[model samples]
Target chain A: MVQRGLLIVLSGPSGVGKGTVRKAIFKEDGVDFRYSISATTRKPRPGEVNGQDYFFVTREEFEDKIQNGDMLEYAEYVNNYYGTPRSFIEETLASGHDVFLEIDVQGALQVKTKMPEGVYIFLTPPDLKNLRSRLVGRGTDSAEVIEKRVAAAKDELKMMINYNYAVENDVVSKAVDRIKAIITAERLRVTRVLGELDN
Target chain B: MVQRGLLIVLSGPSGVGKGTVRKAIFKEDGVDFRYSISATTRKPRPGEVNGQDYFFVTREEFEDKIQNGDMLEYAEYVNNYYGTPRSFIEETLASGHDVFLEIDVQGALQVKTKMPEGVYIFLTPPDLKNLRSRLVGRGTDSAEVIEKRVAAAKDELKMMINYNYAVENDVVSKAVDRIKAIITAERLRVTRVLGELDN
Candidate 1:
């Protein structure tokens, strides 16, 4: 029997180290899994590549997808378009490889409506004080930028109510371990295909 | 914030090695949990202690508790009564130590109705042939007894639709490890009592 793949949606507040923890999880990977390549109308930054880093598209193409519901989740930001393509995710799922998508709270909610059973993991910082320190420690964003990010965190926390699991990103290793465990546990979900063996 | 324990229910065909796997999991120790004890009117075998192996009671007391909705699940077997008491399970859950219950398939459905979100684990033998081999391997039961057990296995398999997860008893270690991982993963459920921390 072909075992079904789990779709794990990961979201967290800014400065919570989700990127660092996710990097550690995908760092030592042997299994076949697709890291979702989001499409954006915005130009790629330096050192970023099209297709691999993202599926760069024109605003027209992004809007067409949103109109057709080809985008599983999408939102307009800063006069630019960003969205997750429906075809790519379906292909990955059909191939029996679990897929991970790192999206913001808004995208996560949109995906939940389309796929109600997708396991969600909300990444949390160790504490508010630590979160502030991490933002200041980055040294790239200005004080105003840090303040905006903190404000955005408050909005993101409200959307996490739909998340099925939560892990505090205090230590990269521990957080990655917890995320990995959540994936492992999700694979055992009774409604999934591999889990049907006992029945 | 205090974390509440999960209510986990396990059911499987008899002689499929669930007992051995459960024992192996608890042997690691330090993981404090209570295995729910049932109230029964059946006469205790040698070495069995009241309120330990089971809450040995008279038929009148068992019936009284059932009338009062104290028994979580109850069934008549071999002209005797056996059932899980609700008070012990409720107290154990209140103490924040996960309560694990091993009951027959019928009782499992009963427990699931009371706690829909409870984690359910269904154990299956490696295969039907192996199940019979193990049942007969014991050398204590007659051929007729073995046949009856095999028939019961088929009936149990049909009720598997109610389970949330299933673990095959291919090897004792593999089965026990799956059960342990389920428990570990359940601890990470975000919406339990520790849900206040999400803020």
Candidate 2:
């Protein structure tokens, strides 16, 4: 019996290290999940390969996909559109390959609305104070920008109520372990395994 | 703040090796759960301690507990009563220590009615044919008794629909690992971690 694969959506507030944790998860052996590369209208940076870094597309083509209901979730920033394509995820899942999506909190919420069955995981910082320290340590933003970013993160934390699980990203390896456990547990769920049992 | 400990209920059909798996789980390091000792009216076998093996009680006292609703779940077989006391599980959980209950399918269903939040796992054989062979392999039972047991197991397997997880006991260690993963994943659920986040 071919069981449909799980859709794992990982999201968190800005600077919560979702990317680092996701990368670590893939680096580990036996973690078999297809990362859903998103489509974007933004210009690729130097040495960025098309279809590998992203499905780089024209603005008109992206708009056509949006109108066709082909985007699982999408967002616009600085006149550039970035969105998850629905077709690839559907086909991958149909073929019994789990798909992993790493996106921002807003995008995660949008995907949740479109596919509520997906396992929505909210990666969180150990604490707000720790998050602030990390932002300061980055040394990229000025005082005003840092304050604004912190405030935005605070608001985004509230969105965790929409997630199925909230994993504290205090340590990247620990977070990855929890994510792996979640996948293992999900596969054992009675609702998901009943089909296999019947066969 | 002391978070309430999880109540894990492990149940399955007859001859599914629930006790063997539960013992293995406790033998492993880092499994901090307390095994809930059951109160019973049956005479203990040799080498069985009162509090450790079973809380041996008289028929009068056992019936009194049943009358007082102190038994979380109970069954009477061959004029002897077997029951789980409600107080110990509640106290352990309130003290932030997880309690593990290994019981029959009927007892598990009863516990679920009282504590629906408990994580109920149903351990299944790889197949019904395998279960039949296992039953036949046990030299203790007559052919007639083995057939009856197999029929009863078939009926009990239907109860798996009410459980949160159904893990196949094809391999003892694999089933134990799945149960551990279920516990770990449950700890990270958003509903359980929200209070920690607020703190």
The number of the candidate with the highest DockQ is 2
Error (Å) of candidate 2 at residue A161 is 1.7
| lDDT (Cα, tens digit) per residue for candidate 2, span B50-168 | 98989999999999998998898999889999899988899999999999999989899998988898999999877643456666667788988878877765676578789999988
What DockQ, on C-alphas, does every prediction get? Answer: 0.25, 0.38
Q: Which stretches of candidate 1 lie over 4 Å from their true place?
A: A29-31, A43-49, A127-157, A194-199, B43-47, B127-157, B193-199
Judged by DockQ cut-offs, is candidate 2 incorrect, acceptable, medium or high? acceptable
lDDT by residue (A1-199, candidate 2, tens digit) is 4688999999988888988998999999998899998999999999999888899999999999999988999989899999999988999999999999999887898889889989999998776534567778899879888788778666866798899998989888899999999999998988887655422
- The residue pairs that clash in candidate 2, if any, are none
Estimated TM-score for each candidate: 0.80, 0.82
Model 1's number of clashes is: 0
Report the Cα lDDT for candidate 1: 0.76
- What are the lDDT figures for the candidates, one per model? 0.76, 0.87
Docking class of 1: acceptable
C-alpha displacement of B158 in model 1, angstroms? 3.7
Share of the reference A-B contacts seen in candidate 1: 0.29
Report how closely model 1 matches the true complex, as a DockQ value. 0.25
